[model samples]
Target: MGIIRTTVITGLLGTSSAAAYLAARNPVISPLAANDPIWASKVFKKHNPSRNPVTQDVCIKRIPFSKIRPELLQNDGPLALEFCRGVWSGWGFAVQRRYLDFKWRGPETSQHLWTNEQLADSTYEKGTAITDHFEVVDKTPSAITVRCGDSPRNQALRPSDGLFEISATIDRQREEVELRLKSCLFSSQGKMDGVKGPMPSWMEELHQWYARIWAETGSWRLLK
Candidate 1:
């Protein structure tokens, strides 16, 4: 992640099918900036960037559809939206290795709210530089997509005008919900898949840990 390019980051957030991995050559990479296919799958596949010198570092994971939350489907307040935020914020705290400022931000629109921001001087990608801006870029009764505005990974690897749109999308189903996290760069050469390198096991573990917790326990917290 080097430079952020132009274009309003289409597919900023979307549902899943793959899991993209973005890690440095060194192991034990930061959890936040590690491999996240939800957003990565959408960015790469939707954008279908070119791989000149670097091969697209991509991975996708498809969650088996599950039952949908009634309140979420009924346009009941902002619980549906907040659910997405909770999943993301949870990861932020883990990545930053700090929880002092990972409080809830409600939501983006007044529809009750769902999003969060923190300037934790986090060690991870965007968390390292900017106050992570995880906003609901797109949404509906069934799905919501969130994007990070100032990810460190994007600014570090992309070429001049090269930018990364790292985001995640949550889709609700009658009995099957799915999540897709992704990271992709838009450079002078179009969309770049990822920096050339395999995501480390340690770094991968960190992300996996957060995701598992989010899917298992975190969702319940948001339900309340």
Candidate 2:
């Protein structure tokens, strides 16, 4: 029993010392570590590609102009200038128009809300324009909803026929912003041929835009 115990203790110490030596030699093991079975497994797990790469349609909407506070709109020129500045500074894009038209009260006394920023014309000019319109869908003192689209743009560029929508809502109560994007890709030339996938890159870009907008407006905390 004494000899067996001595052997076990020696074995454990040997294993511990070997492990420490190995760890010291390779202090950091990246995901691509060639000798690491765990790293190899992780890399292999991410190698997923499909012949039928899913595509999504494009769309965008905004909150209504009417629901925005009058104070927010009190100085249209300065407000627009500020918003435009934010848009350009945040996204590195320029716009031709400062404000979007909003029809209310039988369209006679309608109002206009400035866009946070417009996409650079060069970005969409080459594509077939699908739809480009803005409308006020809702109004309230605390909140507003507006919807806009570039279906014409999509229609021109889409390889096949499909529907895409992108809309955003500003929550005055929570001071939060949410964007909803839906895309449907279809083979315009064929039947029963389509796929759907999330637009992670686009979503990431939108988030950056939001952050830039907040920074430009000096309202970073307003959307908390």
Candidate 3:
């Protein structure tokens, strides 16, 4: 397969045409952070090995309190999780990865398909799966941490895994709630253990750009 086609297939997450419309409507979804925060360093260490380097990217947005429902004001965590869910669900359904979604949700799991309101109201326990590949590994009042591994390929390349986190902080003083999306990607064990793949510079750049677009789109979806 061609590099672009292969890159899309191997992409960390899928995006929708709707996201493009969202981006065009609100070109500046959030303020882009130059680098990941200090707290992210500890999170990366816990999931990945010290030998393998991890790339981190973060996008931040603060929603005004007036925009949020009065009932949701009690806790920032739930709202954060809601935004996280919106992001996950949008990405999954866009690519129509229903088989993967069903396989991960399992027959016992109720609400295989979650609506925006459902995502906002539901509580995600540890091990809960969203977007097929993303599993909630950690959940706290303020943040939700999910992990996903790329599908195996026929080539001798090391499998890649992405650790994504969504965090919400209520700023009563500022009268706005802040939501952050942090993504960390690393190569997992395979033929290229401890060595990064020789991905073309263009592909790497494209992936990063794609991720940013997804983040912006996801973040914006929470408001609508």
Candidate 4:
């Protein structure tokens, strides 16, 4: 019994070490800044009044406007769509999707999972559901915000309801275009109240790690 317990402990430690290494290597996702203007936006203000520390996160990439395609510079719609396509398609996302499928919590309709040309027709209007898991909750000339993870198909699969957003906008002060992915998880009460039941630390850490990997690889693919 002692030997068995030692072996199990060793295996668990090895797994945790590997996960930590991966997260450190790809640290892209980060906590949203306290003073970020998004907090003032009508959409964000409505959902996260207290700014629950455990529930919200953002991933960002900044690229010089000169490097951005000229056609996308003036058109926020195309820029957002293209970036989202890149966001959902990459080796990182592919690996995550496979894991979800293996766990039997993945999309029922594989055809509707990733980027498809049909998304090009999005009107970017409020309340538009796209690609099954994402819905456009807010749209402005400068940004588009989507609420993710509440789809009827995946709700049962997820431990909590959450939302994720992809936004691409010009940052005049920096002379760059900032691409950002934002996410928030809600308690069962349909509120950002972590008090109801806090997520396990390991769960949150795993999620952030995968998010960072996906963001890093996706941003690289977008630029390429």
Candidate 5:
């Protein structure tokens, strides 16, 4: 195991607000945009453009996508994402993301530079593990898209076809967002080959569950 992996294991399993996410009480989140054709039509596809590429469509109902702060959706920001990283523990996996660097090329460009400090997790810790590096591939007041690259640790292991990507967006005119995720083991091997699968249904359910917790944090959520 790497020093980075060893150091974050505990953090992944536990946090100061570990129990906060499990709390029963929460704020009222708007219902999914049942009538918004724009949101209904939006789709998420795997970034690894291979012959057999994987695609996923995420329509989050637990928390409205519009609820996501545009500022927090960028590749890097003033805030540290505070959502429960341990939400996946029930699935026998753990996840955490910490920013390494943030840069803006210029005022004239929408491109922003971002580096992730940590992307190790137990889900792919075996010979199939992967790392994460992200860039703001696209951005709008309504959306942010990011792509994940192999970490040095990952390339040493699954070097041949380890890559990933994700995009998240909310419509001011809708409730749910289209979340494109290919960052974990669920699709690592298939990333470059374009034979990947979407994150499982259970994982999606857990994300909604965690979204409830993240939503409850209110103004204290997803901010610096």
Candidate 6:
């Protein structure tokens, strides 16, 4: 029998439709700094190894109608709001892939929560579930926080068992919304890795893509 290859198209995490006002801005594509040799080496290995290169597409957009802080929503157009969502989603996806093996829970149509069974199925060779629980720790009109286990991907990676803490914060302001994400992992092999960074490279590229879309369509005006 021939091998069946499947392609998973993990679409952008936020915003669906394009806006109608801000359409003239130029796309941004600045190269990452070369001074960080370690990061550069890892990125190069991940993207251009001798054999297979794992590629994933990223899209960013705003979550329309989200209850953003009134002050922030007052002046920014749809483009800005959607851009925030895209950034959040893009960063969130990177965090998930790095720290957890996530599966959908809470209704097929819902985007929140993953089922325990799904989590169980994603155990590492050492017999550990990727995530324990995802909780909404706090919320305000302008900001929210989501807390997960230290090594949320597998049960083997629990804070009580010397894991780290992971959380994400979304802060909305008059002109923009910032997504601050953090993850700490205490590996079973006695390794400690922590990340407090922006979204991945591909995600940044997607933001540029969204900017282009807004520019081309001239659709950044707020909807009534």
The residue-by-residue lDDT of candidate 4 on 58-163, one tens digit each, is: 7666778777777777766667766665656555555444443454443464544434344434455776655455667777665667765545354332334455
The per-residue C-alpha lDDT of model 2 at residue 9 equals 27
| lDDT of candidate 1 over 1-224, digit per residue (tens) | 11111010112112232212212111121223445443354433332345322212222222323344454444423444445445445542343323212432223212212224532111123122232334333444534444343322343323432222222234444333333333332333345454542334443344343333344322442442
| lDDT score for residue 50 of model 2 | 22
C-alpha TM-score for every candidate: 0.38, 0.25, 0.63, 0.61, 0.33, 0.25
Pairs in clash, predicted candidate 5: none
Clash count, one per candidate: 44, 17, 0, 0, 0, 22
Cα lDDT, all candidates: 0.33, 0.29, 0.56, 0.56, 0.32, 0.29
- Comparison by TM-score, 1 against 6, better one: 1
RMSD of each: 12.6, 22.7, 6.5, 7.6, 11.8, 13.2
What's the true lDDT of residue 93 in model 6?
A: 31
lDDT of 2 by residue, 1-224 (tens): 12332333234335655435423321221112235232233211221112123333222223344534444444333333333233322322112122122212223322222233332121121122211332323222322222233222232322333332222345555643333333332333322333332234554233223322223222211122
Cα lDDT over the full model 5: 0.32
Clash pairs for candidate 3: none
Q: Which pairs in model 4 have colliding backbones? A: none
Candidate 1, poorest ten consecutive residues by summed lDDT? 1-10
Give the poorly placed runs of model 4, Cα more than 4 Å off.
1-30, 35-54, 95-115, 119-124, 152-159, 188-197, 220-224
Cα lDDT tens digits, model 3, 83-140, are 6766655552344344554444554445433344555455777766553455676778
Best by TM-score: 3
Highest lDDT model number: 4
Model 6, span 103-170: residue lDDT tens: 33323324332333332232122222223334333333332223333323332323222211111123
